[model samples]
Target: MKLIGVLLFSACVVIATAVQQKDSELTAYKESFSPLNYLNRYKDAAAVRQYMGLVETGKMLSRDDIFSLFNPCHRQQMIALFETLYGATDFDTFFKTAVWARDRTNPRQFLYAFSVAILHREDCRGIKLPPQYEITPHVFLTTDVVRRAYQAKMTRTPTVIPMKFTGSVNNPEQRVAYFGEDIGLNSHHAHWHMDFPFWWKQDYGAVKDRKGELFFYMHHQAVARFDAERLSNDLPVVQPLEWDSPIVEGFAPGASYENGQEFPMRPDNMQFADLPFLTVQDMKLYEGRIRDAVSSGFVRTADGRLVSLNSTYGINCLGEVVESSTHSVNPVYYGQLHNDGHVLLSKVTDPKQRYGVPPGVMEHFETATRDPAFFRLHKHVDNLFKLHKDLLPPYDLSELEFPGVRVEAVKVLGTCKASTPNQLITYFDESHIDLGNAVDTSTYKEMVDIKAVVSRLNHEPFKYVITVNSKRSANAIVRIYLGPKYNWFGQKVSLDVSRWGFIELDRFPVKHTVITRNSDQSTVTIPEPKSYPEMMSEVQRAMRGEVEFTYDSHYRHCGLPHRLLLPKGKPEGMDFKLYVVITDFDKDVVSSDVTVDELNHISSLGYCGVLDGKIPDGRPMGFPFDRRIPNEEQFFTPNMKVLDLVIKNVRQKPME
Candidate 1:
C-alpha cells in the first residue's frame, strides 16, 4: 500500500511540473535570445526587408551587412553572436560624439543627428551643420544594408549621425534626415516607462543633457521623509490621486475659460454642469483609482487621448476661473524645449521654492526607467486619442501648459560663463514638429512647441552657464554641474559673479556662446528674474498632497498618475512631507475602450497543493466569491486602509 501511494504522488508531481512550465511562458519570452535563431530567421532576404519595414529588392548580403540598434548591455549579452555573424565598423568617432552630446541634454536630437551623420558619411568635426545638404541611400547597395545600418547605428556606441561624410569636417551630406520624424507616431508612448537610471545608457550625438531615474532614490530619501518602500519594480511609480504616505502633493488652479458662452467649451461645460453629484464623485474616485493603476503599472498611449491623464502626467490647467495660472508643484528635468530645436531651458530656482508661474500647471513628474514604465507605456492613452480623434470633441491646446517648466529654473550654460545671475528662461514661444506645429488644431487639442527649458546637448545638464545679452553671452554668475568628472555620484558647486547679470552656471563646454532671443526684437533687453518663493524656503518634509495641486475633468485622463517629487538641490539627506488627494470631476466620463472584465487570474499548479495571494470574497465589483485556498493576504500592505476598507466594505473578508 505504501509503494502504490508513493508512485501516485510521483506521477502527480510530474504532471504539475509540466503545467507550471507552460504557464511560465512570459518569463521565457524575455529570455528568448539567440544568434543562431536570428541568422536562421533572416536567411531569407525577403524576411530581412520585412523586419525593417521595407520591401525586398532582390539583394544578396551576409548577415553582417545588416545594422543593429542595441545598447552596451545588449551588446555584451550577444557578444558571441555579434562577433560570429557581423563585421565591425570604427565607432571611436561615433563614441566621442555620443558622449559629447549625451553630456548635454538633447539625446533625442542626438539620436536623430547620429542617424543623419552615418547615412550620409559626413565629417563630424564642425558646428553649424545645416538642415538641407542631402545624401544618397544607394551607398549601401541594398535595403538590408540600410536596415542593418539603422539597427547597428542605434545599438552601437559610435552611432551614425544623420549626416554623411563628404570627405571634409566642414561639410557633410544629410542622410535619412527625416528618419526620426518618420517612425511610429506613437513612439511617445514608450518614453514614460523605458526603465530606470538612464545615465549609463544614453548615447548618440546631442547638444543638451539630462539626469536619469536614479536621482529619486537618494533624492527622495533625503528630501522626502518616508520609510523604505521599494518601488513596485525599482521603476518610478505614478502618483496616486488621494494622498496616502506620499512623497509630494501637487496643487494648481483648475483650468479657467473665457466664459462658457462659447460653443465648444459649452458642450463640456454643460456636460460638467449637468453631471450628477454622485456621478461627479464617482468620476473623482475613478480618477484616483486610475492614478493608483497607472502609478502601479498602467501605461498611457500617444494617441489614446487619455486627456485627463495628461493632468497627472504634467502641470497644466483648463477650467472656468481663467487667468495667470501657476503651479504649486514642480518637476526635475534638464529643462524645456521649443517645438523645434529652437531653444532649451535650464533649472534656476532654489530647491525649496515652488515652480511654475501662474496660469500654468504641473504636468508629469516621474521617470519611466522602471520595470513598468509610465513614459513608454503611457503612450497607449495618446494613441487612443489619435485613433479616435474625430469621435472626440476638439479643444484648443494652443495656450496649454508647455513641457519642461521647472519651478526654480536657471540657465547656467552657454559661451557666457558665470558672468550673469542664475538666469531662468521662463516664457515659451511655440512648439513645432515634422508634421507641422505642436498642436493638431483640427480639434481644440493643438500641440505646441514646448522645448526642454534646461537641455542643450543630446540629453543632460552636464554644465550650465549664465549669460547677459541674448547674443555674445560672455558672462555668468553661479555655475552648477551634476555628475562626477572624477568618479560616479552627484556633485554640487556654487560660484559667485554679481557683474555677469546671471544666476547660475553648470559645468562643461568652456567654448561655444550663449544666445538669447527677445520677441520684442528691440535691442537685447536685460533680465530681471524673480526670486524663489518663500513656501519653498525651508522645505523639510511635506506630504505628496501638501506639495502639489491637481485638477481633473470627467475624462479619466485627469487623475494624478505621475510620481511627484521635490527638486531638492542636495537630496543626499533631506526629508519632506507629501500628500495625495482624491476629488470628483463634475461628471463621469465612460471609458471609450471596451469594458474591463474583472479578471481573477491565478498561477502555480497543484504541486504545492494550494497557492499564494489574497483569496477575494463576497463580490462588490463582482469578484472574490470567498474562494480562499491558501497564501491569501499578501497583496496589500498592512498600512493601506483602502484595501482594508475594500476587504471590509466590498468583500466580506474580515479586516486584519
Candidate 2:
C-alpha cells in the first residue's frame, strides 16, 4: 500500500513538470511569432525612413499615392508573388511571405495593406479572429487607451486613460459618437473599402463584380442606418454639407494614430479653405460637372468623347466617376469628388499646411466616422446616386411580384422577459474590452489584460416569425428591412422618402415550409461569441475538452458585428416599421463562373456581396428599395407590409 501511494505521487510530479514546460514553450512561441516582430524590421528601411521624413516636413503624399500604399494597387500581384514563392498555404504563411516582398515605404501602410489582403483571401474566409486582430485594430491601435498602455509597459509607468471612451459632451454631436464612432462600425467601414477598393486591378479576376454599384449601395445603406439612429435619439436625419456655407458641427476625435499621434481637432464652425492642390472653386466646379453628367445622360471622357449613361451599366459608370475610382469614365475630367472632398474637409483647419496638422478623421476609412462631418459628407454623396436612380423608371408590379406567394404576417419576438411581441429592446450596455490584445507585446514578460468598460448600444436577441401562403415547397428569398415610421418632426414620411432610409436587416433563402428564424440566425447578423473574451472562452473550453472548437464553421470574414444588429433606440420606445418581402429564389440567385466553398456562410449577402466575385442577387443591389415605388401600388399589395414596432431602451448592469 505504501509503494502504491509513492507511485501516484511520482506520477503527479511528472505531469505537473510537463505542464509547466508546455506553457513556457507556448509563451516563447507567442513572443517570437507576432507579426510585429517581422514588420518592425522594415521600419528602418530607406524607403520607410524617406517617407517618414517627408511626412514630418508637412509634405503630403498625393491622394492617389497614399491610397495606393494604404490599399496597395498591386494586391493581386503581391498575393501571386507570395504563392509562387511559398506555394499555397494558410494565412500565417501567406502573410509572412507577402510582408517580405511588400514595399517598405511605410510600416503602417504595409500593415494595413497586407492585413487587408489576408482578411479578404478565399482560404482565410470565415476564420474566427478576435475583433482587434480582424479589422478594429487599425482604430484601436491609435486610441489613447491602447497607446498609453503600450507606452506604460515599456517605461514601467502606470497607464493613463488605459481604457476610457475618448469624446466628451461639449456638443450634442459628441453624445452620438458612442454609436457613430464605434470601433466595430469603423472596422466594418474600413473592411468594406478593402473589399471594394477604389484602385482597380489590372487582372479582371482580382476585381469584384458590381464594384461600382456596391460602392453606391453600401454607403447609401450606411446613411440609412445613420438616419434610423438619429431619429431614435430625437435628431433630424443628416443633411448635406453645403459647399458655400460654414460647417457648424465640428469634431474633436481626441484619438491617436498607431504611432501615438493625436488627430488635430477642427474648431467649431470651421470654414472650408483653399488648398494648393484643391480649392473651394475646384470643388464646386467638379460638382457642376457631375450634375451636368446626370442631367445630360452622358459624361465626357478625358479625351473629350461622350460616354452615354443610358444603358444598364450607366449607373455603375456614374458611380465610378462620382466616387472617382481608377475605373472612372475620366478621372481628370469628372474630378475625384468623393475622395478629394474628404481630403479637403479633413484638412480644413490647415488647408495650406500652416498648422502642420495631419488630416482629420475624414482622411482615412478607420478614422472617418469619428467626425460628424463624415455622415453629412456621405449624405451629399448618396444624393448624387439618388439623382441618377430617380431618372430610371420605377419598378413595375411584374418586376417586383413573386408569383404564387404571399407573406400572411410578420412578427418579431424578443428573448428577454422585458421584451414584448413586435417590439425590439435596445439599451446602453457597458462591455469590458481588453486592449492588451491589440498592443504589441513582444518585449513583455507577461501578457497584460488591460480592460476598459465602454458604453455601447445593444439589443436583446429576438426571432422573426413569418406566415407564408404558398401551394408548393419552393425556395423563396426573404428580405427584411427597417425604417422609421415617422420623421423627426412627427410627420409620416412618404414611401418615396422613407424608401431611401430603409436599412436591410437580413437576406436569405427560406423554404416555403420554414417560417421561423431567430435573430441570431439572420444572415445580416453575426451570432455571439461576440467579443474577444467570449471567443477566448470557447478556445479555452476546447483546449480542456469541454467543447469542440468549431472555429472554421463560425469564421465570418465579412459582416457587421452582432452587437450592432439593432440601432440604438430611446428609453420610451421609439416607433419604427419592419418591412418584409419575399421573392422567388430561382430568379434571385446569380449564375457565376468563379468557384468558392461555403458561399452560404457569406452572411450579410445583402450588404457585403458574394466572395466568389458574383453578385448574389439578380436584381439591382438594393432590389425593391433601389428604385421608386410604382404609382399603381400593385407591388405593395398583401405580399409585403410595414409592420409597426417599437424599440425600447433597457438598462443593463455591467457583467462581473
- Per-model TM-score, in order, reads 0.18, 0.81
> Which one wins on lDDT?
2
RMSD of each: 29.2, 8.6
The sequence of per-residue lDDT tens digits that candidate 1 reaches over residues 260-367 is 110010000011111111232343343343334234333232233233323211211110001111110111110111100000000111111244221111111111
CA error at residue 112 for candidate 1, angstroms: 7.1
The residue-by-residue lDDT of candidate 2 on 48-154, one tens digit each, is 33333444464433222333222223343333332222232343544444433332223334444444554555655444445542223435434656656667677
477, model 1: CA deviation in Å?
15
